[model samples]
Structure formats: C-alpha cells, structure tokens
Target: MCAAGLAWEPLLRLCLSASLVGCQNSKSFEPPS
Candidate 1:
C-alpha cells in the first residue's frame, strides 16, 4: 500500500498537470473546430 501510494501520487500529479496545461492551451490558443 505504501509503495502503491507513492507511485500513484506522481502519476496523479502528472495527470493533473496535463489537464491544467490542456486547459491553458485551449484558453490561450483557439483551435479551429
């Protein structure tokens, strides 16, 4: 459990950052849809 949590934490942070960056990119640059 301890090792799993440690591994999960970084993955979670990476996913969160990716989501945040995607949001920012969408806001900053409009894509043709």
Candidate 2:
C-alpha cells in the first residue's frame, strides 16, 4: 500500500538519522592518552 509505505518512510529516515548521530558521537570520542 502506498499510504503505508509513505508513512514508513519518515520512520525509517528518523531511525537512520538517529543511528547516524549515534555513530558520529561514538566516532568523536577518544581514549585518554
């Protein structure tokens, strides 16, 4: 169904964005030297 697909698109995008932010946060951290 096109309507369901459209609704899921936003949810998928939000999930992707959240994961990307999490990835960036992890990547930005560093261990003590």
Candidate 3:
C-alpha cells in the first residue's frame, strides 16, 4: 500500500539512524580509558 509505505519511510529512517549511532558508539567504545 502506498500510504503504509509512506508512513513507514520516516520510521525506517529513524531506526536506521538510531542503529548507525549505536554501531558507532559500540565500535570505538573504550569503557575505562
């Protein structure tokens, strides 16, 4: 459905950005350095 696809576009973007940030944070994480 076009409407459902449109509605999910922003949600998908948000999820992608969130996961990207999480990935970056995890990659360079130095817990006690």
Candidate 4:
C-alpha cells in the first residue's frame, strides 16, 4: 500500500495538469455549435 500510494502521486498530478490545460484551451477558443 505504501508503494502504491507513492506511485499514485505523479499520476494524479499529471491528470490534474491535463485537465487544467484542457480548461485553458477551451477558454481560449470561441463558443460554437
């Protein structure tokens, strides 16, 4: 469990960063459809 918890930290950080990038990209584009 200890090793797994440590492994999860980076993955979680990557996912959060990806979502943030997605949000920023969407905000930059004009609304459509």
The estimated TM-scores of all candidates read 0.69, 0.66, 0.63, 0.70
The C-alpha stretches of model 1 lying farther than 4 A from their native spots are: 31-33
TM-score between candidate 3 and the true structure: 0.63
Candidate 3: lDDT of 28? Answer: 80
Return the lDDT, model 4, position 11: 92
The best candidate by TM-score is 4
| Model 2 local distance difference test score | 0.91
lDDT of 3 by residue, 1-33 (tens): 999989898999999999999999998895866
lDDT agreement of model 3 with the native:
0.92
Candidate that beats the other on TM-score, 1 or 3, i.e. the better one: 1
Give the winner by TM-score: 2 or 3.
2
Residue 32's lDDT in candidate 2: 53
**Clashes in model 1: which pairs?**
none
The pairs that clash in candidate 4 are none
Q: In angstroms, how far off is 13's CA in candidate 3?
A: 0.3
- In model 3, the runs with Cα more than 4 Å from the true position are 1-4, 30-33
The lDDT, on a scale of 0 to 1, for candidate 4 is 0.93
lDDT of 4 by residue, 1-33 (tens): 999999899999999999999999988895876
Deviation of model 4 at 14, angstroms: 0.2
* lDDT preference between candidates 2 and 3, better one: 3
